[model samples]
Target: MAGKETKKGRKTGLDEAAIRGLAEEAVFARGRAYRDEGAVSDVVRRGDTVTARVEGSETYRVTVRIDAGEVDDYACTCPYEWGGACKHVVATLLTLIEAPEEAQERPSLAVVIGSLDRDALARLLLRRAEIDPGLAGWIEAECAAAPGSDADPAPVAAQARAVLAGRYAERDYWDDYRPAGDPAELRDLVDKAVPRLEAGDGRGALGILEAVAEVFVEDWIETSGGYDDETLYPLFQDLGRMMAEAALMSDLDEDERASLADTMTDWDAALAEYGVEDSFALAVRALEIGWDPPALQAILNGEGGKDSGTWPPKGEADWTEGELTAVRLRVLDAAGRHDAYLHLARAAQAHAAAALMLVRLGRIEEAVAYARKAFGHPDDALALARALAEAGRAEESLAVAEAGLSFEPNESVSLRGAHSVVPLARWLREAATESGRADLALTAARAAFAGSLARADFEAARAVAGKTWTSVRRDLLKTLRAAERAPERTEILLDEGLVDEAVKDVGGAPGYAVPEAVLLRLMEAAQSSHSDWVIRVARSRADAIMDAGAAGDYAQAAEWLRRAALAHESAGLIDEWSATIEALIERHRRKYKLRPLLEALRF
Candidate 1:
């Protein structure tokens, strides 16, 4: 499980065990798959940290901070909140572990900036700022308060407020990136204020953060259908942390410190003032900054006063007591009050937390009970199944896992949810094999493969089938062949290196309207072993496309004819190539618009 060594003799800071420890088995497998599929790129190493970009639904930048051969911290731009390392982080770690040479040594940005002269650095800043107005504002604000200049936080605060307010007008419901004028600008302002707080300007920095927070509260709480909450909640959390940091500065007066503490702890008044039901971020911040326990508990228990009627009053289904109990459990967990956390978790039916806590406390039987009670959730069932199998209860484990697989509607399971199935499938395979039930294993393998294939995952299918593949290969093929989508069957055939079978399967279908890419794959597969068959199939496909008489169809027909000619020539049948080209031109001769396209095809 040791990581591979690079040419420089440095270990990759990761290994199989470390990766497995960082994520669930399913997530680790996905990360490994991503690495194998070449989704990780631009990996760079600097000391103990590795940075890379992983391509998923969108390209996400991932960074892993390693310390003493363990993952200290890891983050990805992808929004996964499952309390574990995301697939992208896992993929980046795998890339570093498996191919250490792929990650080049990179200089830290601070080091690179320090190496530059003031003028050169300024030029660099200006160039970067030209493309980003937010960066430009930051530079201007910082420069305005440079060494000899009178420092003022007011102008910086005003500029940040303007940037934040501009978001209201630039709002677009359709754009995901700039959904609210780039919330990163607000974060940048917060970052810039940090140095000021460290330089004994606690009050000034606090002013700037307060202004930003006010704008966020106004947009989020005062508006009808507010701006994006996802963007705003993180900013509020940042503000809370900054406020706490600023409050620690020695320059702040006792009165100022008390006022900040009040702000942090007074969730009830804030909720009333804003006329909102909850501000989870504020509640978290209160716990983080060590607010008064009694007041914080009151807020969590919903002893907070009624709404201020700034907006309409809450309806019957606004925010339930169960939801409040869940939040309180989180607060208790954060406060390290394990007894309170477990008590509330059970009361709230927060079975996941209860199971985890029981497992942590070495009460395995209780943990298993909770997990079974929550078997309708895939994660809980997975936990129970893994625990049972590890304790040599294979039969019960497989039964629990099979039940968990039915939790979600088959047609509606998302790709993320599908990952939860991987571990269950693995457990079933292992259980079946251990009990000398090869037939049972084969059945599970085939079912898993069919499910994966339905989700367009040939890799998962193959992994599920493993050594049982040869025994079930023919059956799997027959199942695919009987599927309604011809393309799906053809794809599985092509993937298995059944080139002749794939070509014959698709080619024999007379009017199926096979995808052009599939048709091209068919021709490519047949060209070597069945060149004559390639010519015939390509010519027939071209004829069908040309018969449609659309300009697009004509172009497609000409391309297929070109491939047919190449197939003929490759077989040393020069006359066949020429004859096929001639016949195509004659067949489409009356479609004058296609003449120019046909003439361009060379034999």
Candidate 2:
């Protein structure tokens, strides 16, 4: 299938093996199912690129760019962050390979847009905006005002301030301040200021940004009672971009530039009041407006110098001397001062940075050694693994990941570990399979599943286990059954349709000590074939809950009793159901708080 040309004269670089190699076994299987089930549609091929929509739980746009006999790039709009091509992309590729005739002839977006007249385009935008207010706001911000309109800046500033004020008005202390605002109003305000900056109204744009920044900082302080990196980082990034664009205006005189710089400096002062030292806006503005290195360094080092009590500001303040140094390093790197960056990073024991620099300088051996040393720090494990894998040392990459996997706390099993280790395990599995070590591949797949289980990532675990499940089912079941968390083991059993084993593990005499939620699930699972067992388990659970002797406890007991009664009724055991309810009421009759609730349950 290598270099096979389709009727469109584009070579199909992807075959079954290549596509399978690109995706996880489960992802590939799911993608194949999707293709067979006709989930991929609206496929269009242009030159070497194929675009299609893959319908899953959500419709995702998949694009695959194939060049010659190799898959160049694969992307999908779905939020599948498993560190590889998502199922949608796989599905699209499969459709392209199996059903080339289904490739629909779609007009290029440029052609379609060019065909529409101004009025038609406006109408189309209006219709789209009616559906998506965020889109409307963006369009309004971008097109509503001309670059050098006679309109006063005050009104625009007020409009932008009003947008922020309205957004923050109802917020309270417990609310999380999200960077993603109400219908992109914050972005709209920023976008509106862009045209002013483009028109050489640097001062005006700076004013709007300053006002918005003030509101953002104030609201953030009020709602969270502290600064947060997640919110502030993005806000400052936007501000920096605006500052960069405004600083580029050729028509702006020195006075206007100074005014813009002053506006940014004021923002830095405002952040200082809250003990924040990391103001990217001030740093970028200083850099843009040609401030000397020492002055720029002072802005990053906090206004009071390094000896100040607030030099290393604590808690939610993203700016620190170390961060400043990193930024400086980045600037140095960007300015082609690689030697300086490498020296600084090495001196600071910023091994990750040093390794990255070495890699950039094509010093592969030095980069690998630095990466290995960096992996001694647990935080650098993922980066080291990625670096090694990228350098074609797949075995070493897997080894680095395996070493780090044991470092994760074993207090609970969830998919958190899967994110870091699953990719490595997959790489190892693929390599082992290719090297004719199916046993080693199976072992790697098991390790991946174990990591997934630790992370509570059952879907990923299931996916990893899919290929070898039939052969290893008994061993896996034995291992799960012997696990520490009964609920987790029982869940796996139930998910695998091992109902009898799940029933045996979770269903027993009174006083089963698993969590109430797990107990209820076991009872539900047994309700079909083991109705009597469900009734007994539910009664035992209700008794335990009622034994707490609190008002809340009695309410919970009522819920469990209701479940038992339903199970009895479903099994046509009316007498048993009636008896169970009567017994429940008798047991809780003395608790006057629960009397009203019990009376309502009278059959």
Candidate 3:
């Protein structure tokens, strides 16, 4: 219960000792200072809810809802936002040793459908499909498969469908605040969107439906337990119908209309295998173009590609000697091979790249360790400082930053960390709020603002002021003081498709206006910079953006690359600018199915 009452659960096979051990281990291992105050303060049970308030320096509360001996939903007001699983959650789960007798006594799906024959199971599938078409194929598959001596396919298929539906239902709880892409929630959205489209609300339907046709290939990377292409034909057939209608009847702007057209094109091809000719035709015409599916598939499948030896060139190394060394060190550090990467990275003189990779691998301590060793390299030192800060070793991170300032008292140390402080503050704020220490969150927020201010530009840095971020902690506290009521904002700027505005807003924060913000305030600062600078900076940011996109950070990556492209243009580097812009256009096409640049210029 983050600002509300804690729910309790019926006590059954609850193990206080086990939960306590797990809780203590999680807190102590994580180096959390709060767990030392006390033990589990209160263990209350109410129906299916189990809530515990652990007393440390402050009260740390947790709510756990158990379903069939498994932890279903968990929430904590702590700074541990990644994956939404904190010590409190682990503690609560530890506390739940088993389900209550009543829970176990309840009739499971197996009990109801266990006795059903093949035909009976198929009939049940028909019933479930009436509610959700995704279940139809699953049921059919179960019916077709030969039954084992003890096997019951009907209940098995039904259980699979239930699990899928449940994932969709619980998606709202999975926050985007985590670092890894929320693939589970996205797939859940797809499951829900398919059903929602049946009601004919295209905009609302599309809102939930991200244009992830590229990801569709990735989704099939691993074989799943659900229906295959053969059995799932009807589902695709339905989807093709939806796409056809969406393309023809869509009132979206040119870019969005093109995107819908793109969907139509993809579904038209997809539906061809299902023999849905009518649906396929509508989808094909909606895009105002047509392509032979077999020909296109052949090319994409790599049959018409250039020579294997000439294209990509195997074993020559994808990067330069220096870049490869850097990548190796990063890999070593990430793999917890700290000693190896550290030694090799230094021997190879790739400290900067190694340090950056170490940070990416979450080896904060190891990164700092390498940085200390590579103090001879300024770039490596900077990367180490960033890694430390990113990993929440803030005090050490700050020390590195300050030391860099002492030797070469420049804007690099300060401005280098401007972007990283957002998440750190978020974590700090979360921890502080959970421990009844608003002052801590506020302190982190002020430090974040100060870091932003150090950027040598003001207006540009405040543009990324996310409401959940620690930089906005003061604003939250200030709102409380002024009695200014604002709805609690949970979603990120990009989540609402306002990433461009967010960049501007974060740069405009009172004490956060850094030099970069001011310098970039001009219309074409990106292109106006020196040619060498444009090439280097655009390529750097472009690479980072692309990495982020590959990891599903679409909105954030798109905005960063856009700025990079503009910079290239200002430097009179038309080819570089156009190439970067084209990449961004492709990203938009794949993500929202809209070409952002073409839409803006109408070219």
**Best candidate, TM-score-wise?**
2
Residue ranges of candidate 1 with Cα displaced over 4 Å: 1-106, 110-326, 383-423, 426-447, 454-467, 478-489, 497-520, 526-564, 567-601
lDDT (10s digit) by residue, model 3, range 97-135 = 432221222333566678899999988877778999656
Candidate 3: list runs displaced more than 4 Å: 1-134, 138-186, 189-356, 359-366, 369-445, 449-603
Encode model 1's per-residue lDDT on 1-603: one tens digit a residue: 687897678876568777867775446666776889999999988777788989998889888888887889887877676768988998888888788889888777878889999999989988888898768666666664443345566656666666666655443335432333455666776676666654656556666666555555554444424444565656665675565444433355546555655664554356446444344333333334342345334443444344421111223212323333444454455456786556545534456667767666667677777666654566566776776667666776676766766565222111112244544555565567677766655555655655554434444445556676675676777777776664466666776888877777766553246555556776777787878777777777677868777653565567677777778878998886676667767877888878887877755
Descending-lDDT candidate ranking: 1, 2, 3
| CA lDDT scores, all candidates in order | 0.63, 0.61, 0.42
Please name the candidate that would achieve the greatest lDDT relative to the true structure.
Answer: 1
Poorest lDDT segment (10 consecutive residues) of candidate 2: 409-418
Clashes of each: 0, 7, 39
User: Which residue pairs overlap in candidate 2's backbone?
Assistant: 278-319, 413-454, 414-454, 414-455, 414-456, 415-455, 415-456
Candidate 2: stretches off by over 4 Å: 1-114, 117-159, 166-183, 187-211, 218-319, 333-336, 360-362, 377-379, 387-489, 496-521, 528-533, 536-566, 569-573, 578-603
Question: For residues 1-603, could you state the per-residue lDDT of candidate 2 as single tens digits?
Answer: 554456666557668878877876546756776888899999997666689998988778888878876789887766476767777888888887777778865656777899999999989988997887556544444443446554344554455555554444543435644322343556665566666764566555655666556665565566545544353556666666565544433345667667756766776666677766546453444434442345343443334444322212333233323444455555556557687666556544556677767766768677766665644443345566567667777766656655654444322111112234555565566656655656666776676666554324344334445576666666666666667664466667676777788777764766355545556666676677788877787777677757777554565667677777667777888886777567767877898877776776666
**TM-score for candidate 2:** 0.48
Query: What's the residue-level lDDT of 152 in candidate 2?
Result: 40
Model 1: how far residue 42 lies from native, Å: 14
Clashing pairs in model 1? Answer: none
